[model samples]
Structures are given as C-alpha cells and as structure tokens.
Target: MNNQLPPPPAQMMQLITGFWTSCCVYSAAKLNIADHLKDKPQTAHQLAEATHSDAPSLYRVLRALSSVGVFKENEDHQFELTSLGNTLQTDAPGSMKAMAIAQLGDHYNAWGNLVYSIKTGHIAFDNIEGMSVWKYYEMHPEEGVNFIKAMSGLTGAVIQHVLPEYDFTSFNTIVDVGGGNGALLVAVLDKAPQAKGIVFDEEYVVAETKKLIAKKGFSSRCETAAGSFFEFIPENADAYLMKMVLHDWNDEQCLQILNNCNKAMKAGSKLLVLDSVIPEGNEPHPGKFMDINMLAMTGGRERTEKEFASLFSNAGLKLARVIPTHSPMFSIVEAIKE
Candidate 1:
C-alpha cells in the first residue's frame, strides 16, 4: 500500500474536471433516471422514452455516470442503479435528487461568479441574482419548496450519525431554531419521547413544517412557530437545537442569532449547534470546501472551534464542549447559559 500523493498535474486535472461528474449526476437526477432504474435495469433508450429525452444523449450520460459508480452498465447496455445512484431517488431516505437540481440549477450561476465574490467580498448569489437567496426563494415558491426539501434531505443524511453521538433524552423541551420542515426536531422527539418540540422559522417555512408535523403524527407533542431568529425566539426551552443554521450567516449576524438564543434560553439550559467545525491545519476536510460554498452563496462560513468559542463568548454563553460525531463533516458545539 503506497501512501505517496499523486503527481501534481494529474491531481490538478482531476480537480479541475470535477464538475464533469457533478453535471452528469445532475442530469441523471433531473431526469429521474435513478427512480426509473430502481425497480429494474433499463437500456438508455427505455430510460430516454420514459424521461422524454434523446436515447443517444441519455446513454452517454448513463455511461459517464457508470464509470463513476453511480450506475452499472451491463453487457447489453442496460443501466442499473448502484447504491450511490439509489440516493438520487426522490423518495429514498436521505435523497439527493432535489439537492442535485438545486446545486446545478439555482446555485450554478452564483457559483460561476465565485471569482466576482472573491474580488469584491460580496455574496455572489446576490450579485448575480439581484436578490438574497432567501428572497429569491420567496419570489420563486417552487424553487423555495425544492430548496427546503434539499435541506431536509441533507439533515436526514446526517441525523443518523448525530443521534448516536449526542443524547436528546434529558431535555423536556427542545426548540429547533430555524428548523426547516421539522425533520430534525421530529427525529429528536422520537428518541426523547418525554420532550416536546417547537420548529421555529420564518412564516413561509413553518407553514409546510406544520403539515409535516401533523403528517408525522407528532402534532400534539410538537408545534410550529413562525418568526425570524434575529428578532425573537420562543422563550425558555430546556434545549435549543440549530443544525446547519448559523453557518448561513457571517460573524455579526451569527452573534445576533446567538444573542437572541441567549435571551430566550433559561438558566442552566443548553444550546446544541450542529455544524461543521473546521479543524485547524491543512488536512483535507469537507467543511473546507463547504466554506467556499458559503462564501459564494450566503456570505456565511464554516467555523473553527476557536471561532465558535469566540462567537459563543460574544453572545454571553459558555462553550461547554465540542462533541465529534461519527462523520467529520459535523460536530455538536454545545454551549451553556449560566
């Protein structure tokens, strides 16, 4: 087993051409190819007819994705879903279909202007789209719903790893601040049956969240609140959970949110912030790249432990500990209200 790095030019070429794979996967996802292939193997011609696409062009995409292990090509040119491909199924657990569309659709233009953001220190999405991502979603409700589904998909992927690492059973009440669609809170409440929850977010978002809560048959134990985290949060929950929330803001905005959480928190309560805590030094990490995505789209960032500690202190909370999960992409940054 060799531990040496690949030659620089070869590695750089792979890095530069990474988008080829992304675009191919996006095409597959957009066309619902994975869902079509889920029950049985199908030739690209069959898939093309089902998707209303050109057979030859669709075959090329399936062939490309097959090389990357997203699908498998057989002797007769039939394509079948690999385990990786199954994740792109719309109804699959932790589905990435919506995420694929979003990243390649709405987020594509903003990411293309990343150089502009780098040069001017402005949000590329706002510069390119002429509105904040949130407002853009509001004006485009279909896209907004897809975006929410994308977030829920992402949360679904990570929650399995998170629940085992942290205990939610102790809290009698949990508030998921900026909880989109109540997925995380619902999962937590399932584990902590003694705990009731509130899914707190903007008015538009919580409307859908309420329906989800009722659908999950948790309507009595969990409720939805419509409001912004900047102005107010529901007061005095035993625990507040913010998963992938603070990473969408800059330091000043983060402080405002933290402060609001502080004001709403009762003494001896805990705030569990689930986000990527970028470690120090040059070891490769997903958060390092996600940090760039933040810069390009939201003017936000992934924080280091030191950064989180400082942010917590500024909001008058004590950084209790940073708990690692099975996945390195996230950590539980636990803080306490004294």
Candidate 2:
C-alpha cells in the first residue's frame, strides 16, 4: 500500500478548487443530464437536442463530469451514465437532483457570503436574501417546494440506516416533530405496525404532508398536524422524533423548541433526535462542514454530545444514550423526560 497522503500543495489546490466540481455536478443536475442518460448512452449532440442545450457546451460539461466518474465518455463521444450519476436522476431512490439544484441555486449566494456570517454571527442567507429562509420560501412557493423535496430526498437516503439501528416498536404513538412530508413517520409506522404517528409541522408544510401520508396509504395510521414547534407540539406521544430539526436553530431557539417538546412529553416518554453529533478533535466529519452550512444558512449548528446534554438538561430531559447508525452523517440521540 502507498500509505501516504497527497502532497500539501496538491491537496490544498484540490480543496481550493472543490467548488469547480460542485458547479459541474450542479450543471449536470440542472439540465437533467442524468435523467436523459438513464436509458442509454447518447452523443452530446443528441443529449443537447433533448435538453435544449448547446451541443458543444453540453459536451464539455459532460466530459468534465466524466473525468470525475459521474458519467463515462465512449470512444465515439457518447456519454453513458455511471452508477454514481444514477443518483442525480429525478426519481432515483435517494435522488440528489433537487439537493444539487437548491444548494447551487438558492443557497449559492448565501454560501458565497460565509465570511459575513462569521464576522457578524448572523445568518448569511437572511442578510443576502433580505428575509429568513422560511419567509423567503413563503414568498417563492416553487423554491420552497423544491427545498422540501430536497430535505425529503436527504431523509429518504438516511432512513434505512436510521431505522435498523433503533427500535420504534415499543411506542404506541410516535410524533415526528418538524417532520416534513411524513416520510420518516410513515417508514417508522411501517416498521412498528402497532404504532400510530403524527407528522407535525407548520400549516403550509402540513398541508403537503397530508397528501404524502394519504398517498402512502398511511392515512389510517398516520395523521398531519399544523403548528410551530416553538408554540406547541402534539401532547402525550409515547415517543417524539426530531430529524434534522434542532440543528436549524441557535441554542436559544433550540431551548425553546426543546422546552415545548418537554412540556408535551410525559414523564416516561422518549425523544429521538436524529442529527449529527459532531465528534471532537480534527476529525474529517461531515457534520463539521454541515455545521458551517447551518451557520451561514440558518444560524444553527451541529452540536457535540456535551452540548446536547446541556440542551436536554435545560429542557427538563436527561440524555439517555447516543446510538450510532451505519451512516456516519447521523446518530440517534435518545433523551427522556424525567
């Protein structure tokens, strides 16, 4: 084995130019190039006509992506979708298409101003867009819907790893606080057969969540509620699940949400928080990067176990355990109402 790292300059250069790859992937996703290439290989000219893009320009982009193994270029100049590229397809299981578009489109400007966020200790997105992301979503419904889809896709990708690592069967009622689209709740209900669930979120989000519950044929076992976690949560659930919710707020806001959950929880109830629990030291963890993303986008952060314990204690709960999933990006932070 080589057992050696890349030279510092080479590594630094790659890190500096990482956005070039991101942009290339974003372009392919934006143009639906993966979907077009899904069936079979096609020449750039053919793909260009289908996507209404310039043949030469599209070919150049495809060629660039091919170098990184997203797609493969044949001897005759036809591009074929690789396994990695399949993830960008619109309907692929755990698709990244929406994520690609949103991060590069709506989130691009905010990320560009990351320095401003660091300097001011504020959300760059709010400053850049002149409104909070939640408000911006309200004004631009299309982008809002896409943002929701992006989240759903991300949740879908991690659900398998999360479900198998923990037991949900003991609870009679599972409340997915801030659960969007009912995907996680529906999946949990499916695993727990006897348990009913509620997909709780804001009114507009819950309206869409209802449709997903009904579409999944879980309408009988799962329901949707409209409200904010800051004000209230559905009361007396056996278990409450908050997947990727708390990380969107600062400590003060998280305390408010957690306090509400505590108020609604019974003495014995369990709260399962599904988000990254960042490790200490110079680890190459995704949560560290995501922590920065949270800072720029929502004024939130990924917390360490100590930080979570503090939040739990202040919110009238005790940290029970932190269970690891197969995926490194998430963990089940189980807490209990005392």
lDDT of each: 0.93, 0.92
For 183-228, candidate 1 gives per-residue lDDT tens digits of 8999999999999999999897898889999999999999999999
Show pairs that collide, candidate 1: none
Position 232, candidate 1: lDDT: 94
Q: Indicate the worst ten consecutive residues by lDDT in candidate 1.
A: 156-165
Question: What lDDT tens digits, residue by residue, belong to model 2 across residues 282-307?
Answer: 97999999999999999999999999
**Model 1, CA-based lDDT:** 0.93
TM-score of each: 0.97, 0.97
Candidate 2 global lDDT: 0.92
Q: What TM-score would you give candidate 2 relative to the actual structure?
A: 0.97
